[model samples]
Target: MDGSKVALVLATSAGGVGRHVRSVADGLRERGAKVVVLGPASADELFGFTESGARFVPVEIADRPHPLGDVRAVARIRRLTRDADVVHAHGLRAGGLAALARLRTAPAPLRLGPAAPPLVVTLHNASIAGGLTGAAYATLERVVARGAAEVLAVSPDLEERMRALGARSVGLALVPAPATPPSPDLAPSHEPESSQDARPSQGTAAPSRAAAVPPEDHAAAKRIRAELGAGDAPLILTVARLADQKGLPTLLDAAAGWARLDPPALVVIAGDGPLEAGLRDRIAEENLPVRLLGHRTDVPALLAAADVAVLPSIWEGQPLIVQEVLRAGRPLVATRVGGVPVMVGDAALLVPPGDAGELERAVRRVLEDRALADRLASAAVERASRLPTEDDAVDQLLSVYDRVMRTVF
Candidate 1:
């Protein structure tokens, strides 16, 4: 977009959404597009949108809906996006607020007033709530569907839902991969069945790094293992914020089952959030073999140090951790939910979202079966090579903006 003015709106983002918006701002600014990011002041403080070279404006669009707050946010968004060529909103609540501002009325109460600058909304995650909360979110989905000129979805399920809700145009949004680190080395396994071949096979796209692990990574992995008090036992790693959506209870349940294994696996969860205290209580109460390593910055080392990685999210939208795991070339066992199956293909063993037994089985296979682990690790590297880049995301985003502009103008 040569000098096109684009306003990016999002809610109070703390994790992937915040990083993604910042990445978009950086990419758009580098391409000479005038980008303005509007979100909570805390998000700017966390993600540094202004540091990414985009003009940062604070408009409090919250994760949860509030009557007075929504009104204030709608007014702020409407005023800020008035001069832009296009307005792109991320997440459900932020998109709904932007849509209300752009349409000038609740479409159910009255007809759409005007689509002045053309609105585009990106649906990043699916609703996991039920009953009244789910219904409220569904209503917002319809509002966004009816208001946006075009909608971009992060997963197939999200795209299908938007289309069914009557979105004008719906397409898959490409989440760019996280920065790649040096591929991890296979951990020494004490299990009789494990310790088989764990290297890339003959392939054109296979990672060209040597069989030897990077020295610094090796040292870091050793340090992390010792610090965690994991001696000869294998390390089972999960890198997720301790939240309901992450299905931590199921992970703990699986950990309970694995606790009986001789030289039982040490489960390490390396992120923190609202559910930290609850998860900590469950671990102590059940005496589960799981440790919470709250809000870590050394994920690459954690991946390198682990025997196998697991993700048991109830729903996810192209999670950056999965991409990072693939780049690390670690064997993964993730739930077959949302974008995960498409992301991992045959690179990971897929289990149902809440099935602790199946999850335990899949993870155990990677621990006990050496050949499977090697194949998954090799396949992960091949998959990593094909994931979308930041340039690809910007090119696709510009295409959407261009098309929407042409239609609106």
Candidate 2:
């Protein structure tokens, strides 16, 4: 792979995809592969691929569907892939653009040879949007599937979706969590001191983000917890982008029911999105005991400060936050969606998606039953042991690249 050139294309650099791309690029570089990244300009600011030793090229790729932007992105991708040995695209939009670019830039029929590069697309989400938007996305998925030489899904559920979308060569590759170590200062106090020692070491816990938290940031978390009146109260933490896909509405409804209990639990949601205004309105109208912290960087501290972590997403592809929570040794309550069940296994209390009553009951059970929460936490540490580290994920991905190159060229 020393002389091989791999181009990674991404649509948005704002969420988990951006992080994943950065990790892959770093891994490829470590393996002596030339790597180039093409994505929205914001990706540089968000993930800093250039600073991390990848050739970063900005392109006009929007997160949502746009005919004009897609055309521009595809044209740019074609130019970038001129010297690339492998064009690996992440997410649906980027995959579509890369596929179209490959088609437009293919060598003439008479000149076509085994040296032609392969296009590998990794589908991060299997969810289809509702109404007309869903139909449009479905159409794009079909185009991407038909064009890509290989389609990789982050979860088994998404692998099935890829196959259904006409992908002839489909594979599964679970997204790996970052390897930032948990902050020692932010470690939760409820777990026995021997908890970490009790678990068998599997070396699967991903390295966390930089462990050094500013003193002020730690203070801020403490102040926020205090403001929420979380004194001896079971604190529930949810870190997700506020969107329809996140199932915030359902979580709010469950919160409302939980609020009516004799001693309501305090909930803190740490992330912002387009649904912020509407979610705030609903929170005020319902008077739920939930706080929204927009886009936090100190999630490790927050996890250490919370009693339980919950993910109520309607759909997901191996959510990183879920893995983070488990790595922090916190009990989890997540909906059975996408690869969540596979990620959590028996470590979390799984509930049906969009079920407010069941969600509320699960949260309540965790809060009231100390023994149950302890059991889940213990299981969480062990479950986290099974997760692949960033290095492992990179190794698997490079193997895929090799396989695709072999099959195509």
**What is the per-residue lDDT of model 2 for residues 16-131, given as tens digits with 9 covering 90 to 100?**
99999999999889999999999988998899998997899999788788888787787788877878888899988888778778663433312332344688999888645778
Worst 10 residues of 2 by lDDT: 204-213
**Pick by TM-score: which candidate is best?**
1
For each candidate in the order shown, give its overall lDDT on alpha carbons. Answer: 0.83, 0.78
Q: Write down the TM-score for model 1.
A: 0.91
> How do all models score by TM-score?
0.91, 0.88
- Locate the minimum summed-lDDT window of 10 residues in model 1: 193-202
Please give me the total number of clashing residue pairs in predicted model 1: 0
Q: Model 1, residue 330: displacement in angstroms?
A: 0.3
Off by over 4 Å in 1: 107-115, 180-216
Query: Judged by lDDT, which candidate is best?
Result: 1
Clashes of 2: 7
